[model samples]
Target: MKKFQVVVKCSLGIHARPAAQIAQACSNLRAAVTLETDHETAQGNNVLEILNLHAAKGATVTVTVDGPDEEEAAQKIQAVFEAMGPKEKKVPVLKVAFFGTKDYDRLY
Candidate 1:
């Protein structure tokens, strides 16, 4: 068995995309992969379960892989987490100025 920790960096937490990527990483492996956060544990290859973990930003997740391909599975999942790290928010920033006034408003 092998275990490693991953920090959740996605602004939206462990949402669908990361879950899918985690699942895909384990698709061809012969190991049993599981992910555990402070509140929950999930099967690494199951998207729904992975999502269910609700690992928010900055959450530490423990990845555990056991069986014949444990090393490969662990490495692949680690790569996926690294590749899925934090993303820039796409929200538009807005700035407004009032006429004849040194006042401005900003929205993120």
Candidate 2:
């Protein structure tokens, strides 16, 4: 088994696009791959699992690979994490106050 730790550099963190790309890369490898952060763990080849980790920018995540091609898998998987650059800012959703029909609704 082989592994490496990396910090997320992308501002948006490990969102959909990078997660998909990382998953695809892991899928192409012969080794079984996995990733873990302080908050969560994910199967490296599974986009949904990776996204569920919510590894925010500057967060550290460990990449692990075990199998016939563990070394190469580690190298490539590490690259996927490093490839993501600074995050781009997106428009924020506007939230509004809601009025309730009953006095009890004010608790919200």
Give the top-scoring candidate (lDDT).
Answer: 2
Q: How do the residues 66-92 of candidate 1 rate in per-residue lDDT, one tens digit apiece?
A: 999887788898899888876666988
TM-score of 1: 0.78
The 0-to-1 C-alpha lDDT of every candidate, in the order given, reads: 0.87, 0.88
> Going through the candidates in order, what is the number of backbone clashes in each?
0, 1
Q: Model 2: runs farther than 4 Å from truth?
A: 87-108
Write candidate 2's Cα lDDT for 28-107 as tens digits. 88899989988888998899999999999999998888999887888887778778976467989999989998878978
RMSD of 1: 5.4
